[model samples]
Target: MNRETLVLPVLAGLLTSALAGCGGSDDSGPGGGTIVVGTTDRIEATADAPAPLDPAQAYDTASWAVMHNAFQTLMRLPRAGSQPVPDAAESCGFQDNHSEQYRCTLRRGLTFADGRELTSRDVKFSLDRVRRIAHRGGPATLLSSIDKVETPNEREVVIHLSAPDATFPSKLTTPAAAILDSHDYDPKALRKGFEVAGSGPYTVRTEVDGDRLTKAVFTRNDAYRGELEPRSDTVEMRFFDDSAALERALADGEVDVANREFSAEQIDKLEAGRVAGVRVTESPGQAIRYLAFNTKAPAVREKAVRQAIARLVDRQALVRDVYKRTGDPLYSLVPTGIAAHTNSFHNTYGEPSVAGARDVLRDAGVRTPVKLTLTYTTDHYGPATAKEFTALRDQLNASGLFTARTQGVRWTRFRQDAADGEYAVYGMGWFLDFPDPDNYIAPFIGKDNFLNSPYRNRAIEDDLLPRTRQKAQRALAAPEFRRIQDLVAEDVPVLPLWQQKQYVVAREDITGTEYALDSSAMLQLWELGRGAEG
Candidate 1:
């Protein structure tokens, strides 16, 4: 349950082999089989769905899972492994002046499902559309590095960086950089729900109401040339409301694989060999859960209150009780496996003790019996979140320095309230949109941060990030990232709680399941087939 298990030693070194087996088999159909996958809700393929498919608009990990199926970028860092590979543009290597500008030439004849010719214009259109829509909740941060995108011709796209960006091409490998067909996209039309319009292996064929979604089988587009080749003609995704339902479906043989939304208890049951014929694979997840204080609130605006709470709760107990050994206690926002993720907080704070909590409050000239309302989401993360918050409430109360009242709400509503600055303090979880130091910093440290946390660290925003983004070499990314971690520890705006490992369980017929730095790592649909026993 410690933090050392998560950070990638060298970011690029790991990316080299990340998605090795994610590419699907070349065989046409599943012969006579169907791979049923389980999720928490039904997917409606409209622009307005809870998880939309528009690459420019998606920010949530769940949405990106669907979006990636429809769109592709010049290059992609596969979900299972650590390396960057060409997905759409054939091959991508930086052109001259490796500093502020890079140009990539497209492979000929790649086309959208609707037969729109894929070219440099398409890439430009995707980037431009993201900039134009500029959804406050979308992938605007990913596009923050680009100063401008120029398509001089149909085949060539040149991206001018705002600073020296060594990771620009790698950024493009994510779904955030997925190219869309501008010809069919309507900027004026703000359609919500799921809709597909790109060149991935599968197309959104239909959605049956009541939480079950069926995707019309994938057929190789004559122009499609990515590494993945679909084996099943069609894939059906059944969505449930919770882990219990999803697990039940898996046991009942209603689904062939579990994509996401399983509780730690469910994973344990599967791991204990309780579910026969099911093969389980585990990976260190690049996800972190933390307590984010809303600095905009008057009481939490005090560092004493924030630090006191951080000292009151025990991270190891929290992981063991709530996460069921599926999580590692976090000492830094950048989890252990990522490059430059140092245990700066643990180095500073040590461990949770009542004396430490009292000292922080006393030093800030705050008297005992500090009362605050702590909020948590019931639906988000898992069923254990409420119990986790209750534990936090008890721990703080037991410290005798603070009295905490707890509140719980569904995830969607909780997010709306958190964004509106309604809570004094709340439990939060962050699964990276892309695995980078910027992803760790930019969202939580800026003036307009994601958590409604107005915790602005000028060092991260003005100095560390700008300096780090300019270098192309991965080795150079470490020092700057470490500096940001130190600053994050000092500010204490968000208390790093724990980093969770993601687990996937499937019938033994499946193989090649693994974790990706970006939380969307289980590429079971690819390289999964019936085993010899089957």
Candidate 2:
């Protein structure tokens, strides 16, 4: 996992438990024997169609989680608190002039479960396919930097980019960029859904259904070669149709782990040890939730109108009421804890004030009494999202800056509609596409921002983003991102609302399961064994 993908629990507790010598936990929470996990399935907020299991075609977050376990990247980020580290590659660095050519030397003898030797050819093919498929608007836009990929030898893969990019390796860390067996997948058949073939520790055998997706099991690959040391022989990933039902399962010992969907109140209950033997671990994640304004909408077109509306949002109140203080207030498109993140916008917005918003609108000669629609997803991001939107509407309307109308959609149709720019303003959340500022910038800026916001800030698109991506380190990347924040604050196409902190409840029996900020929330199934003495 990449650092951007890491969640709340910091690296403060790396204390070696030597507990491994004592043997793994036997208790899978309140239940006995079977180790079930919980996931939300009622809402298909992402991945509505039959998608190719190929990394190039994997666009939705759900697919990425599944892919992360089955495939290995050249390099992986540290668990929440550590730094960006190597995973599949023994070592990686810039190999040529101006840092235009990047190279990673593969680990010796790395082989897929199918027994095909993993080579630079697989890496080249993976990236080449991302540019080719570009399905459902995958993160291929980031690959616009790539000019070509060359493998002179079996072990060394060289990537030539159109421009100097510091974030290229981070891109490789994303599931959209996962490497796969060239022999197992056909690039042409990817759109139609090919068999799920990958190089991670576990392989997908089947998809079954019950309270959780009872039949989804990942079996250990004896031929697998990667940094992660998985413990379980077979991981049965059970998907809960609902969070409440999932919680009941956890309380009743039906599942070994659950996270992402729990509310702050629910977190408190779990943390209080309401369910015996279930341990709750809360960590700071790289997740950001924001309100996206469709620039095409007449009301939000003017900079002053956008800025005025941004000022009226009570981020703190939302954190308190909606997230139960589990989330931190975020002011930028990028959340805290990620490399190159800036608080410039939050600094500018300051505390919410009705008078302040009114003044901004007044100065722009914009009239009040404007009614706008706010859209939110019903099923994705948990149940509190709709209520959060309602609270925002109440707050905005109470301020008398504007009258608010709310629209809620199920995850599947909602994403399609939102992407079509159906709402005047919508609530959108982003987990990092990668840990870099490029992921944050490219997705929300320019005409191509995912929301179809059509926010064309030439300076940011032309200068800031390019310069930042070209920089080698996050320190050098900061100034450019800071400038991007200024543009976001000045333009307000989308307002940064809040940063989320994730709370996960796992049966103490499950070890090494964690949430990363990047939204992957990938758990190493092999590292997860039953309780000690199992």
Which has the greatest lDDT?
A: 2
Those runs of model 1 whose alpha carbons end farther than 4 Å from true positions after fitting are 1-32, 41-51, 78-81, 96-98, 208-223, 514-524, 532-534
Give the per-residue lDDT digits (tens) of candidate 1, residues 1-534.
Answer: 000000110121111112211112334455335555566632333323243555555555555555555677887766544456677876666666556777787877788887778889888878877777765455656667789889888888888877776767666766668888878876534335455678876665545453334432333344565677655554555557777877777777766666455667777888898877666667676667788788768767888878777777798998888777777899888888777789878877888878987888888998779888989877656677788888888888988887789999865566667767898888877766455666677677675456656678777888888788777666588998988888777778888888767666666554333332333241324444443313
Q: Per-prediction count of colliding residue pairs?
A: 31, 31
**Candidate 2 per-residue C-alpha lDDT over 1-534 given as tens digits, one digit per residue, 9 for 90 to 100:** 111111110111111111111122343332233455566633122344345345655454545556677888887766553234667788888776466888889999888888989898988888888788765445566566789989999999888888888777776666766787888777654644434677787887645432112345666777888766656566666656667887887667666666547766777887788888777666676667778887878868778878877788888889998878888888887767766677767678777778888998898898887788888888766778888999988988998878888888866676667667778788777766555666666776766555556778889888888788666756777877878887788888888888777666666655545322223344445555555533
lDDT of each: 0.65, 0.66
User: CA shift at 300, candidate 1, in angstroms?
Assistant: 1.0
Winner by TM-score: 1
| For model 1, the run of ten residues with the poorest summed lDDT | 1-10
TM-score of 1: 0.88
- lDDT score at residue 404, model 1, on the 0-100 scale: 85
